[model samples]
Target: MGKKEILVVDDQPGIRMLLTEIFTSQGYRVTTAETGQEALDSLYAGSFDLLMLHYKLPVVDGVQVLEQLEKDQFTIPAIVMSGLSEDIMKESQQFEIVKEVLAKPFNVEEVCEFTRSILE
Candidate 1:
């Protein structure tokens, strides 16, 4: 089988770089996108095993991206990260496709572990 591919979408370059390094170091094929539309475009162009998305993405929010993906029948797993409160996370959980909700200021190891757990 080929290397697992992961898409990391965030508006911040620093965050995208950090995630790219983390996933690439773990032997995963990594792709970075700065906006939700870019993420969707990337998704349409290639296959990915998972998506790591920032909740407050520009052009389209994480939920919107997930919705679009579902509408298009793409079933890849997703991890949504946000600095929002627990209440907001709970609200977002109404979306069935979200595999996990990660709070901001999270540990890098935790993110890697979650991604590994889901993909592996």
Candidate 2:
């Protein structure tokens, strides 16, 4: 297979940069968006193997993005990142596309490993 493409949505520039750098180093093609609208645009424009998004965003937020995707019948496995992972985890269970919930300040290695396993 070709390099797995990941769409990472986070309002925080640092978080987006960190994940983009780590995933790129690990041989994944990473695209990032600062708002949920941008993420939705990217999702609608092209194909991606995975999605990683922060729960709190500027306007649309992560859940809104997922809801839109669901409404459009766009299916993609997602990892929801949040400082409040426990709560988001419970809330995200309702979305079948959400395969994982990651807490902020997470280990890069773990993220890489999980992503590798998922794409593999």
Predicted model with the maximum lDDT? 2
Superposed on all Cα atoms, the candidates' RMSDs to the truth, in angstroms, are 1.2, 0.9
Clashes of 1: 0
* lDDT, candidates in the order shown: 0.88, 0.91
Please name the candidate that would achieve the greatest TM-score relative to the true structure. Answer: 2
Candidate 2 off by > 4 Å: none
Q: TM-score per candidate, in order? A: 0.94, 0.96
Error of 2 at 64 (Å): 0.4
Q: TM-score of predicted model 2?
A: 0.96
Least well predicted 10-residue stretch by lDDT in candidate 2: 110-119
For residues 12-105, write the lDDT of model 1, one tens digit per residue: 9999999999999999999999999999999999999999989899988787898898888888998998888385478667766678888887
